[model samples]
Target: IISPDSVRLENGTSLCSGRLEVKSNQSTQTWSSVCQQDFDQQDAEVVCRELGCGAPSVLQGVLYGDVEPPMRTTEFQCGGHESALLDCRSSGSDRTTCSPGKPVGLTCSEPVRLVGGASRCAGTLEVKHNGEWRPVVYSDWTLKTSAAACRELDCGSAVSVGEREESSYRSVWRIRSDCVESGSALRECAAPDFSFSSSSSFLNLTCSGKPSPCWDNLQL
Candidate 1:
């Protein structure tokens, strides 16, 4: 089965933007220019949506860098509404036609951002997963956890943490309180085995303007 986590952009400045790549045969692989050249706004839309990004903001020739030889090539006939790239009609054996150049690159509207709050930097936390915006339920939501999120969003440092009842938000992922202390990336700290559940509880954060540097970028 193809998991939502299997699709991602690598070698870019952020998780929401990078060189497009897909996982296959228990390994991750990059697509050649054949895939890039074939991609249009429609294909970019599906890829961005599947990665839980807001929308396709930018789709063009390689912005990250070049992929070396032995690259995987595929042709996608996406209807522009598929949930995953693999769901599109694809064929992978046409490597000979691919041009030798940088691979495809994409950028989403906002891969991670704050919402239901006063500003872009403060609000109930929501992260995109599986082409949906889901809440983050920290069993022990704390300053450290909030800090991690703030760092991820480039929203400075966490000053305080609070809770609010927001019944409309449902969470498909959770972060164990203990996982925060290890300084893992917010996405990395996420517990993979949990399923989605509807809940009203959410963490509210206040962060400092001088954000710290952290890394843990995933498409979903």
Candidate 2:
């Protein structure tokens, strides 16, 4: 069985996000890359669960840095409900034609989490983008946008919106005012524009209730 301790995220800014790697039996005991495979979101779900993360939000290829020699390859056949990666059927294999220059990366739902608020459903909004966490700015930020973000985090309806000043400065803003629309998922929004000045203003939101599994199933 592949113990949870044997799996880890490498080169990511957070524990629940980064390139997936597994401890190997190779001579150097080096970590083996878990990218460049034919696995889909179902397989990624298993990886996140094994890492003790909430859920798989993003499954990307070659975003993380590359691996060195002795990289390992495997095919995961997960049913999308396994608790651990080893609980799924996996087969060892040589590198395939789809091998990526870097490695596969994953971002769990926790990356876009709430903070500095009264409850898990309310807080100063922060999002993990390009391996860094940045506050969402208040410029042109609207109620619809806030609702979209809250929905992205699996939080219920957006109940309120406010702003706060940051003690430290951040050069980048993860979301622009018009980036999100009503009834749209945050991932479907455009990438942030870093050209705008780092406004000291940050956005805060309060969500109405618990996560709705139906809404949470919506894809980017």
- Highest-TM-score candidate: 1
lDDT of each: 0.64, 0.66
lDDT of 2 at 106: 75
TM-score of every candidate relative to the true structure: 0.63, 0.49
lDDT of 2 by residue, 1-220 (tens): 1226667777774567778887766467767777555567888777776765557766776666766644566677889888776677877564544444647777765546678888888988776544466666666776777777777677878898888876555753556556466443343343564655434777788888584444244232
Model 1: CA > 4 A from native: 1-8, 12-17, 22-35, 58-60, 69-79, 89-97, 109-112, 130-132, 141-144, 165-172, 177-185, 192-201, 208-220
Tens-digit lDDT track of model 1 for 1-220: 1225657777765556788876654553533333466566767778777766667766766576776654556667888888777788875555545455647788765555567776777876666665556666545787877777777667888888887775553444566656655654454455443544454556677777555333234221
* Cα RMSD of predicted structure 1: 6.3
RMSD of each: 6.3, 11.4
* Least accurate 10 contiguous residues by lDDT in model 1: 211-220
